[model samples]
Target: MNAILLILIMIAMGAIIGGATNSLAIKMLFRPYQAVYIKNWRVPFTPGLIPKRRKDMAEQMGRMVVDHLLTPEGMQEKFNERGFQKQVIQILQREAKGWMHSKRSVADLLKQYAGVTDARGKMTAYSEEWIDKKLQMFIYHNQEKSIDEMLPPEWKISAESYFDSFAARIADKGARYFESDAGRVQLETLLEKFLQGKGSVFNFLSSMFGNDKILDKLQPELVRFFRDPSSAMFFKGFIIKEWEKLLDQPVWKAGAQLNTKSVARYSVKALNRELTVLDRLDMPIAEWAPSYEEHIINKWIPELWDQVQPALSAKLLSVFDYLELEDVIRERVDTFSVGRLEAMVLAISGKEFKMITYLGALLGGFIGAFQGLFALFFS
Candidate 1:
């Protein structure tokens, strides 16, 4: 009778105390996250020791993550890690081959990959249209920081180079138009009109391209021509020369408006297109040299930067929010993360949380053993 009674009591005590301890320990981790302020004297370990310390912990974790698991440089180091990306590409190639060998046009696969609705549907958003909200945000939010940090920052490198590049581009453009028949004609018209009237020549070309006035007979050919890098480079050079001459004009020296407003507006439009081009290529902007980047950022990025910052920050935060491991673990306590799963039997960090069962059994066994021993020896 004593043995039976003692066994039941031991089991009850162990069940209650063990559960209490585990709960208390875990609770302590998150409880005191915010510091307590009383009489301007702070309490020791004011709140969640585990999570309250998490700011520093998070910073360290951030650094560690940047260093080991997901650092930009580290990721690049493992670019072909386990050949996963390569294997994916190879699988795609094989699948493509299989599809080719079969009856389907790869167009069907491309449509699926491209998120086309179906064979009957056209793309709602192509490379040019898709926002890549992440990259957009990065470019938008970091515009000022990007300029301050990326530009040479020297008076010559930063300010002078900026204007000089602008002038150089404009002058280079002037050379093209002033020299080329198409460009010379525009300039000749402009000079003649300035000598007498206002934009008597460009007035026609401008009016013709206006949406309601002229159906863009040139739209298809223009889109195709603009897609060529060499063509763009040549025209860009031509425009730059003309721009340089405008900046150097004696009328401006006498304090005429340098017409900076127009230049800035034009730059923003050009950069918007350049960013679209880079997106289509799926190229990283960081790959460009500083000087080359100066041309892009300095010349083209100002107008859209302010509009895009908030959008970018929100998108970046969204991606990070999705990657939060703690939330995932708590939400699905039985599950482990992809990292933990990949490490699998190596860490024995499987989903079973065998520890729950193991701990319960071990503690129960000890409690039972103590009760049995006490009943045998003392009771």
Candidate 2:
């Protein structure tokens, strides 16, 4: 019995040592790769499991990321997790505030506004007169025929939607110009003088032309602006301001209900009259169409693009609201990068290996003790 007991103890000790040695050896296989390759000596496969098939390992890792991590379903699952929206909003808010509070933002905004005012003031040096002259020239110098000949044989719904969209776009673009600080100041000053009946931009021009008859001639076109608001946005704004004063109303909503309806009816009447005159007299607007796009493109479009561009650009000054910060931290966090373990866990049967690694010594020791008991019983 003593001899048997001694043999059993020796077996258990040998088994424990062997289990420890094997576990350590397995760990060493992945610890590092590529020992120093100096002179004529080598570590003889000392460099680990990854170095043996590094290129293949890389391709496999990329494949795993694409298949398991970067898929639409996986991404959606992550996005659907709790507190995601709050995290995103917080990040966006922080970024906005950071940008808004930055000194760079102040300098950039100042430069941008300065450039705008400088360019606009220079162009408008005598803009009112120049625009008036150009519009008049367009009205004049036509052949003795109705412009109806240029009309298409049929109207199109698709074409109408396109035209309306283009018109709306033009309206939006023109909206940006007058929304500026300098623009508002100039427009307000001009209207104030006009409404008080103390200022006449026409008077200045009339004096220069040596006749007030030109003012009388332009009465038709000037009245035409109120009738067709889109064509005369600058004047339409003036009309609105004057009406607001007359009504003594703080809000447009507080004014008469018929205001919008009246404006619409007047606009329609004005457009119809203008079209009739255009159809009677030879003018391009009588046949504005997709087919005519090429002709206008080659002729008037490029020639007047610079002057007309202002009518198409709208100014928007964005100011973001506060209370957003968690998003900033989360977006900056949740980025896990574990290198070899990351690659290994994604590979075949390696996830099980990872679980085993945490408790391998304990598990391996238990297995070795069972092996020792079996050896003693058999001996």
Best by TM-score: 2
TM-score of every model versus the real structure: 0.29, 0.32
Clashing residue pairs, backbone N/CA/C < 3 A, model 2:
87-327, 173-312, 173-313, 174-311, 176-314, 176-315
Give all candidate RMSDs, comma-separated.
21.5, 23.2
Stretch of 10 with least lDDT, candidate 2: 314-323
Best by lDDT: 1
* Model 2 CA lDDT for position 337: 28
Per-residue alpha-carbon lDDT of model 2 for 193-257, expressed as tens digits? Answer: 55454457655654576332443444334444434547545544555555435334322223223
- Superposition error at 17 for model 2 (Å): 2.8
Compared with the true structure, the alpha-carbon lDDT of candidate 2 equals 0.46
- lDDT per prediction? 0.48, 0.46
